[model samples]
Target: MGFGAMNLAPVYGRVEESEAADTLLAALDAGFTFVDTADIYGRGSSEDLIGRMLEKRRDEFVLATKFGGNQDSHGILIPGMGRPDYVRRALDASLSRLRADHVDLYYLHRLDPTTPIEETAGVLGELVEAGKIGGYGLSEVSPSTLRRAHAVHPVTALQTEYSPFQRAPEEELIPACAELGVTFVAYSPLGRGLLGGTVRTAADLEEGDWRRGNPRFQGGNLERNVSLADRVATLAAEQGVTTAQLVLAWVIDRGALPIPGTRKAANARANAAAGDLTLDASVFRRLEDIVPRDAAAGAQGNESYLANLDK
Candidate 1:
């Protein structure tokens, strides 16, 4: 398991700097050495927080941050974002905010449709050669894109949203990563808290929480999704574990590196502990039966969000 810093920012709701700092420190202390963040997460706010809070403990963690990505819009595939020159600048900017000489792993947050993936990989390879990044990865890209990018320069990881609610990656992405020796970084492995029963209704989220704007958290969709999650929750109870711990364990069992985000120290510790928890085949079978692949309701994301995925 790894740590996701997106929620450390006020992405889901208001989060104080002290709380965020504690969460980051706690996550590291709790054995989550792989920390993942993005430049666009809070538009640099998340990286800045990580930089300030964890700078002293830098050597203790493997830092990963992404660049050149934007969604929740037209999925325009900004030409400049993918250009070689901009990629260099983005790394420098990320490094500055991360307070690090080089990120252990850097990902292209959005696959640039306008530019050949090979070209982008070439620039990232240059960065690695120049000591700006240890390695480069791709996000929301197709298997073909991964192949093309890996051929140019060895791809380090492939970061995407994966969980029981979002199983599209199982079709091709997981197989390609396994074949190419790439890490399948699973973000939102807990179905963004829905599978954990953390979110029940739209009203369960804060007024400014971004999930409120998500189609999956809206009226009827929220009810249907919660019902599915409840079944999993019941099984989790019978197994004497929190719904979240069960979900996290299942994600690890699936051979993907799950990086779940939380703003609480207790939750961070619990998440890390879940990585070490063992699950039996019976539990896995029950989980699959309760929530099979593609068993989610509502739009996981909007048209713009889907456009950038598997591009």
Candidate 2:
């Protein structure tokens, strides 16, 4: 299992440093062998925190980090930068922040429209050969883009959102990755806490919480999605598992490695236990009947962010 480090940062909400660190250690103790992070998450705070928490036990986990997003001085993600020179600088910066000589996997956080895929792949290949990163992957990219990059260098994985609420990847990305022999790494498999049956209304989110602006959580959409979540919760209750575990089990059964993020140690343990739950075909059919593909209320992200995703 993998642990997503995004929520450990203050990006989602105000996170206590001690609590976040404890949660990370708890995840490791719980048998999470892979830990994922990004440079833009919390404006580099995610990597810095992981560096501090895993400094002594770095070898215990397979570290995966991403680059390419350009952030301003204030930590706002502006756009993607995949130029050759930027690639080298970004990797060096990430290595320094991670306090590690190399990462198990390095991903391009987003496609840089300004740079050719071949050029980006070439640089990543060089990094792999130079022993800076073991493998390279891409996030939120299309099959065509993956093919183009793979032609230059093999892509180890494709990190994207994949949940009962977000099944867009199954239509193409998943099959493409399978055919290419590249692992499909799923992030946000819990639908950003929606499928967990915890967020019922806007009031549930803290001020400046990013999900507040998500279309799925706004207006009539929120009510509709919550109704769907309630149905899933009922099914989970019947199966004697948390709603999060049921959803994660479904994702894992679909052949994707899910990296669910949480801020609490209890939540981390709960998510880690999900890997052991085996959902029967009856449960899968029931879940499918409850949450059909593309049944979500809105797009996975807002317009500006959606624009960056490879079509």
Candidate 3:
């Protein structure tokens, strides 16, 4: 389990100024050693926060951040950002923003359709040799791409949407990672907070919340999804664990390191405690029956966001 720093920024909604530091400290104090962030999150604000807040406790955690994808002035994704040259610049910039000499793990935020995986992996391998990063990984990429990149350089981790809410990875991606010895990092393990039992409807999200724009949180989809999650929440109640903890525990049972982001210290502690929650095989089977891979309604990301992701 790890702390995902994306929500520390304003991406989810309006966060208090001290929220980032509070969440970071809480996560560290709660026994989370891995923290994941992205350069694109809050347009570098997340990285900046991590750098500033963790400067004193840098050795306490394994820090991971990603690059390769960027947005234009209008927040439109700029394609072809994964070129070797761009990756060099991006890593340097990320290192600067992170106030660190090297990250424990660095990942390509998304694959560059225009740039071959082998070429991008080659540069990342060189960076590892140069000590710019401890290791390199890829995000939202296909199994074949993973193999190609791994042939060039071993991928430290593969971060993607993996949860009871999103299980497309189980079909092949997760198997491929296990086969190649790549660590599978599961982001949004709580279904982006739906499995946390807070988001009941679209209106539960504040104005400007990123999930508000996600198709899964809209209209009929949100209704159906929440209905399914509520069932799991009830099972959680029976199991004497919080909904988020149950979800995280299930994710762990599936052999993933889940990194769920949060904005509150209380939520951070609750999420971290999921690591210690022991569930038996019967509980896992019951949960699986409650919410299967295709149980969640709508897409994981919006069309625009999905366009850049590996299909």
Clashing pairs counted in every model = 0, 0, 0
Q: Which ten residues in a row have the lowest lDDT in candidate 1?
A: 70-79
In candidate 3 the C-alpha lDDT for residue 195 amounts to 89
Global lDDT for candidate 1? 0.88
RMSD of each: 1.4, 1.7, 1.2
Please write out the lDDT profile of model 1 over residues 100-145, one tens digit for every residue.
9999999999877678888899999998998878999998889999
- The alpha-carbon lDDT assigned to residue 48 of candidate 2 equals 94
Candidates 2 and 3: which is better by lDDT?
2
lDDT of 2 by residue, 121-206 (tens): 99999999999999999999999999999999999999999999999899999999999999999999999999976699988888
The residue-by-residue lDDT of candidate 3 on 1-311, one tens digit each, is 89999998888889886977898899999999999999988889999988988888999999999998786655456877778889989988888998999999999988888888888999999999999899999999999899999999999999999998899999999999999999999999989888888898777899889888798999999999999998998999999999899989999999999999988999999989999988898998999999976998998878778887886
Model 3, residue 222: C-alpha shift (Å): 0.6
Worst 10 residues of 3 by lDDT: 71-80
Best to worst by TM-score, what's the order?
Answer: 3, 2, 1
State the number of backbone clashes in model 1. 0
Output the lDDT of residue 288, model 2. Answer: 87
* Model 1 root-mean-square deviation: 1.4
